[model samples]
Target: MNNFTTFFVSGWHHIVDINAYDHLLFVMTLCAAFKLKEWKQILVIITAFTVGHSITLVISSLGYIPDNPKIIDLLIPFTIMITAISNIRNYGKEGVFSNKNVKYVIALIFGLIHGLAFASNFKVMMFNDNIIKPLFAFNLGIEVGQLFIVAIFTLMLFAYSKILKGEHLKWNIFVSGAGFGIAATIFIGALS
Candidate 1:
């Protein structure tokens, strides 16, 4: 592979890595409350997160933010837990597009935390003299990975919606519960 492709592919794999799935879990939880019809809102939410992580990724890559992997490791799952719980609490009351500002803010904040985690690895791996190209490629790769996850999630939710025949709340609960359980496990593992 070419140099650019190498960096981009590395970033994609890093985010979507099955063994290290905190990022995927976060994306899943963030997108869980929406239906396939709410694609616009989902795009906005995903953009918020991308912007958030990009800000911190750039800052951290420039050495402005310290790489605190342990703290970030814990905070990552905490963000997931918070998002999952929010879905569980607001499942029925809030429409898919309601309170979007709130979701955007959460996604941004959590994305910043997740960016720090990304930076811990990025700083070590990035070797180019001009950081802009590789950094942009890496961020692009992350967005692609995130969008892939969102697409799969949207499809799964759509299938479940059809299967349940309007009992989508149960699907939401199941996704949230699973997110919560996984986040809790990661949070505990980070502590140990």
Candidate 2:
């Protein structure tokens, strides 16, 4: 395969891979606060994350930032936990997040940190002189991967709410709590 194709696949595989649960958890937590009817907001939040991470990836490509893996690792889970806690805190509050502007900015900031967490690996993946094409392709691939995840979560959540008449507050708490628990575990593990 060509360079773009190789990096694209790598990006998709990296996000969807089960071992990369931190990224997946972060994405899921972002979506947990919204209902099925709020898909547009979800997409915007994910896009914000993509944009933020893309910025970091580009800057990292230019060798501008320090690659502190330990701190990045801790920050990744911390962001996830914070997002989860936020969702849980606002559970059942309809208009609490009605204005999604804050969420977009938060996602963007979190995305920047998440991108830093993977900067070393992403940098190593670049082998060609032409970085723009591969970088664009990789970010596109990651976006697609994140969308796939959002789609699956939306469907499952939708089914629960529709078929079982699931309580929105209950689900928000459950999903967000799960995110918090897992991220806390990761954060603690990284502390060791």
Instruction: Give candidate 1's whole-model lDDT.
Output: 0.83
- Candidate 1 stretches with Cα past 4 Å from truth are 94-98
lDDT of each: 0.83, 0.89
Worst 10 residues of 1 by lDDT: 91-100
Question: Which portions of model 2 show Cα errors greater than 4 Å?
Answer: 92-98
* Best TM-score among the predictions, by candidate number: 2
Pick by lDDT: which candidate is best? 2
lDDT string, candidate 1, 75-183, tens digits: 9899999899898888757665248888898788888888888786777777865778877788788888888888888888877778657566777788888999999
RMSD to the native, candidate 1? 2.1
